[model samples]
Target: MQRRTRQQLRISLLIVAIAAGLGAVFGLAIAGAGDGDGETRAYARAALRGVWTGGLIAGLLTAWEYIYVNRPAGLWVRRLTFLGNVGVRSLIYLAAIMLSIWSGATVFSIEGADPFGWNAQTVIQVGFSVLFSIGVNFAMAINGLLGQAVFLNFLTGRYHRPVVENRVLLFADLVGSTAIAERIGDLGFHGFLNDVYRDLSAPVIELGGVIHKYVGDEMIVSWPDTAAGRSRALQCGIEFHALLAAAEARYKNTHGAAPALRIGIHAGPVVIGEMGDVRQEIVFLGDAMNTASRLVDMCRTLGRPLLVSEALRDAEPSEDGPALEPMGETGVRGKTRPVAVYAPAP
Candidate 1:
């Protein structure tokens, strides 16, 4: 989890630095009226100071979310302690950062001390800073770590026109979801599935997988095929199993049932682009996505918790490579060619 936090911290720092730098440039440009270049120089110094001060605060806030709010384990752990950690962390950050900022302003005239700043202006600015920190972090928490990558592409129109990309996809479905739902009732099932999604995210993100989408009880994760191979997507599935197994006692106590996960992996080309007029979104469309889903469905029929296609599976550096057993080629719903399936060796 510390490693996960460190990975997320890099993204947080990048987002905050860009935001603060842009804010500085625009703020200075607008205020560059009187004193000519002297005022510009002042703002430049302020901008650099602001970068360190604001960036440090942002880093702390991101780590707080990882330790107490954003992570799956954090969510449940906080739940047990009545979310006391959430309240405690929130207050500590608020007091500590504001005091630090106020001190930096008074002693060092940090950020040029926000010339002509009023109490209301300071309050509003701090409010916006808080909102920006929460928004960016949660966006990454809800979306994938590559959220900025996708959004940056959308902004640059890099994906405005469709482009073919080779990606490895892993589709996972919660086995016996219907039966579990029936026993737990709709309301209870909602919470159970929420837990499942939250739990699944840690392994996927930690392993460098980006979530493509979540469809009802199914989750689709993607990565560049080359990166996927290097990251060992196969181990991710096995890791998920080990994770759930380790949490079995907790799952039973909290949800009153233990759930099984079935996952399938495949790799090929997909059309990636930004879509929609009113609100833009990144979309992936191609047989690769569908084939991954179908292979996941095959998990139930084939009686394996994990499966991979020949295209995605590979011989590792280990003496025995990956622990994969052949499931042979099978017909897929949307493709002319049958996909070769392999299950992990038990």
Candidate 2:
């Protein structure tokens, strides 16, 4: 299966699992509160019913999102104003929740229970489900606002305090960005950059790299400092190049020019920490980032699309990888020592 498909499936399963677990706990609590004669049996039945209902709701919602809302073809949906999007999703969720509750009641109803009853319990259940759906929508919005890695890190408190850790950093800058922006105006350039970034994101996600940030026309991608990380980073660069090439025609037809990237990679220890007050961000600080940026700048002089620092080249296992042609050591600004670099052999 393709990496993106696998990723989607994994996420869908995780969502269902979490939903099922939470539903089961809520079921048990509800059952305990009732004065039932067969309390144990009632609890067991409620938990089982909860699992089915929760899993069904989550599965259906996830499928809809992956199939429509999250795809590029969903531009109409995406272009909706914030309030418009929320209103639409709210109605959709309400419909889905009602359907889930009806289905669950039909399947799990006791002999005397009225599946279509309009009782206090039914009202409470629907109200709770609506609240839950709203909460889920809010969480999804937050996750979309913050990239996945940053959002997860924030939740886990992974970088609450500064810590030094080795990481492989890749800097990818758009080629001829200034000329492109001048040719197509600022607004057009902004749309073009969005398209380019959308195309670039797949390779990074598939190769297990986290996008640190986008600086103007440049994107910073990072991976853990390990043999596997180095290998993935190298592979990601190649894949990124291929992606841009594949989309060249589409880009030219849409925006009058196709974008290209000059990538530079390096590996070293960097301080990772959460910074800011009202608007917090996870920041990476170290020489590695600066060196990578400088290397990308050098790409213009060297006329290479991609450049790898000697450190990164040495760290990555080359047996099954592309051959690197040595580019003699070159001086990069802000560093006293000349950094040796290599380009992937043509």
Candidate 3:
């Protein structure tokens, strides 16, 4: 704010100096008009003085507009836009002042010591008009820009922090990850993991889901509402299945056994927020996430790559997702009632 203010102040002072210079130039031109003859010289001088006085005042008004409009607070001023608004308001004031002066000089013919007479009434009226226009413009401009800035920030990833909400959640982890990492080694393993993330991100993003975080060989993702959220969770399973198949083919040629992965999806609300003080990360909270984690843990028990809840299957069965089969009801640690489980089709 201070920087912007200083910049505006400097510009204003510079304009004032320039206005003074212009006025002086006009005065000199008038003085030199009649080859220094007494009568012609006096008329030239008076005309120069009149024009310079008007020009100086107009220039000052323009300078003020420029300075004020560019200020941070000016965004709220409707009549004033951002920096561009300064120029706009300046032009409006300039035109209005010129019209007022012209009208007074032509109609009233108020003759003073100079050919062009100073009409206090015209100046006052135009001055007020300029002020009124600027004030109104400034207010409108600021209000509109504030909203624009917010959306712009969101679109540009400036406000990347996520909001936590109750919803379905999924946690996918790579099985035999440690063995695979050892085979690929650290550097190559990092690349391999990045490739998996890149491949997985598109489907999630397309379905309006957000990637929560990566936990070593595991990744957690969430969707917005329950239905759409479950859709994304299921879609992720299908995509991950297909993607892993393709990756397996490549791995067979390059290395040995295809790396296996397990995915567990649970439907429920979870608190989401940017976690960690050093590098803020979007994370999930609530039993939903915990349930999802446990479901993935159950993958070891069932010897399956993917498992989902009946709630997810019921939400959108025909939608894009892995072909699933009922796995019967099973008791989970936290819940008293037995939960229905489904295995994702290979």
Candidate 4:
């Protein structure tokens, strides 16, 4: 399966599992708090009901998100302002919560009590559901704000202390960005950059690369230094070009200019850790990053659209992949020794 599809499926399964687990815990608590009649039976029944209800609600919401609400470009509601979109989604979620509660009570209740009755039991259930939904939504919004990899690392404290690890870094810079910005006004150029970045995100996600940062018109993406990572980094470069080509018509039609990019890939060890006090963030420091940046700068001078260092090229030598043509040893700005660079044959 495509990586993007696989990612979505993984997230869906995780959501369901977590929701079901929380549901069971809440059920047990609710049962324990009730009057001491058939306590054992009540706990068992409540737990089962909670599992079923949680799973059902989670599954339904996941489907809605992946299929209609969060689908590619999504519905017209997605184009609405941020607050407007949030308002619409909140209404929909409230309705879903009410429906789920009513249906679950009807199916599981033995006394046949009025599901719409605003009793303490009903009030508590609705309150819990609303609070849980709010917490989940808030987490998701934070995840979107922080890139997936960064958020996960922060959650697990993976990079709390400095760690040395090998990683493949790909630097992609928009070619002739200054000219494009000049042609289009500043505001128009900002929109153009947004469009370009949006288009570039797909290939990176599909290749399982984490976007490290954006420097003006350049985007830096990283992957663990494994055979798979090396291969995907190279493939991502090719795919990046293809994507820009595919979007050429749209870009030209919309902004009167088609965008192009120059990419550079390199691999080596780097020190990674969370840094800063108020504006804290995970940062990578090493020659690998510097080398990768130098390679990208070399692209403009060497007139190559894509450049790969000898380290990366030698790491993943594939017979089926595009041939790498040697560009001869060249001295980069900061390095005293000349670096060996190669270009992917067209």
Task: Go through the candidates in order and give each one's C-alpha lDDT.
Answer: 0.69, 0.83, 0.64, 0.81
Clashes of each: 0, 0, 18, 0
Between candidates 1 and 3, the lDDT winner? 1
- lDDT string for model 4 (186-246, tens) is 8988889878887788788878889988789999899999988988898889888989899
Which pairs, if any, clash in model 1?
none
Error of 4 at 261 (Å): 0.4
Query: For candidate 2, lDDT tens digit of each residue in 1-346?
Result: 8667798899999999998897788767766777764666777877877787788888888887887787777667666766676666777887877787677677776433435458866788878877877776666666666776677789899999899999999999999999999999999999999999888887787778988998899999999988889888888888889899999999999998899999999999999999999989989898998999998998999999999998777544346667888999999899999999998887
Q: How close is candidate 2 to the true structure, as a TM-score?
A: 0.89
Task: Write down the lDDT that model 2 would get.
Answer: 0.83
| Top-scoring candidate (lDDT) | 2
- Candidate ranking (lDDT, best to worst): 2, 4, 1, 3
Q: Can you give the TM-score per candidate against the true fold?
A: 0.73, 0.89, 0.50, 0.88
Estimate, for each residue in 32-137, the C-alpha lDDT of model 1 and write its tens digit.
6324445756666555545555655665666666655665555643443323443445465675457545643554352424542467546765786566545553
Sorted on TM-score, highest at the top, how do the candidates line up?
A: 2, 4, 1, 3
lDDT of 1 at 337: 90
Model 3 / residue 99 / CA error / Å = 39
Q: What is the lDDT of candidate 3?
A: 0.64
lDDT of 4: 0.81
